[model samples]
Target: MGSTKHDGDVIILTGASSGIGEVTAWELAKRGYRLVLAARRADDLGQLAGAITQRGGLALPVPTDICVEAQLERLVQMTLDHFGRIDVLINNAGVAKAQDAATPTNPHIDMILGTNLIAPMRLTRAVLSHMIPRRSGHIVNVGSVASYISAPGQAVYNASKHGMRAWNDTLRREMKPLGIKVSLVSPGFIRTPMTETVRGMPMVGPETVARIIAKVITHPQREVITPMAYKFLIALTTAFPGPSDAVMSAWRVWKW
Candidate 1:
């Protein structure tokens, strides 16, 4: 059944306190999906949940640190206990510790890899068993343009996203026969707290991404690149890595 057949299509969204995740929650809630919001900030999660509830929807805030395996386990258990089954898992929680790779300590590496890569793997594993038996579910992995185009000061972040895309691709093929759909939503830079310091770059708003994500949930696809323009950029960069690298190198030195 399509996601629109929602009287209680339970969805668990991570990184839901702000940015794309936040807006996506509103979009899905308005469409009748029951939400289980997870994030590190309890106050923000509660506020967003309250706002959704005020809008005459079902949203339960489960303040969670996705980096913590125990917390992630608790989150899935809570959602299942409350909603009975998870129709969708939106792995939106991600972190970017952009700096020169040489200076990264173990903690920095762990933090980036843990939140951006390991967390999703674990969360997906937790929900896989549930979705597999039913043989019907969706997993949306939110990635970035960096997954295709690499640049300076984003070595770890780039690695994490590339890893996400790899996992999403493999899982997509593996789960196709089981009726499980996996989608990777890769977007160019978005105007969010995470990218506030990135000036002079074209950035789409979070809602733009949320809309694409909402559409993908209903009409599932293997992958989606928002704004449609990034698809060309990604194609060019992938086809001509040498020239792409040179151009990106020059971009790092360009004066704003």
Candidate 2:
């Protein structure tokens, strides 16, 4: 897959209206990849597509609530209808809410897991219907450091990301034999609206992650942790759970 040429490749990008997805859309479009943008915000999605088209890039905005199974199907159908083929699927749409796991209502649990975990799984299955037949495509799941380190006050979010990481690893093996590449781009704290209120961590702009996603599409690695430093943190935490637990306790005190 590394040697595969990407000229005029059609990529479906979810959560394109903001954050990493928004920046990634621009990055991929600049690299000459045809894009199908999907998000719940119709106006923002349309504006983004229009902006890309104005700059001589191919973009089709498909407003979709990824949580809805039907909309996920429609998004893929629309992309195939417009572009004739889907070369890449970037599952970037996600949501997080900081609250006590015991206090969260069922809706809260559903929203977090639905958007961050289940939606991607279902969307990937929908896209695979097409990619499997061609035996040529790439699936990039945007995950979080939370997948590895479960911080305080974010239990459900941590669970969602953890599930995502597991899914990505197994899916990569399953798709490998079929010639479809699966990659996970996990990042530490990022300077997006999603993390604006977060503190006590070094943060990078979403563009940094966006560039990595674009590169992964061509180079194709199994998993990539951005900023590189987080890889060491994840290793240390996994090796010494007691210290990680103490730090998480301190974070809980400081946060709440």
Residue-by-residue lDDT tens digits, candidate 1, 1-256: 1236655789999999998899999989988899999999999999999999998889999999998999999999999999899999999998876677578778888999899899999999999889999999999999988888887777888899999999999999999999999999998888888887776878789999998888898889888888688889989998998998888877751122
If candidate 1 were superposed on the true structure by all CA atoms, what would the RMSD be?
A: 2.5
Best-performing candidate as measured by lDDT: 2
Q: How many backbone clashes does candidate 2 have?
A: 0
Q: Which ranges in model 1 have alpha carbons more than 4 Å from their true place?
A: 1-3, 253-256
**What tens-digit string does per-residue lDDT give for candidate 2 at 82-178?**
9899999999999988877678889989999999999999999999999999999999999998888887788899899999999999999999999
lDDT of candidate 1 at residue 106, scale 0 to 100: 81
Per-prediction TM-score: 0.95, 0.96
Clashing pairs in 2: none
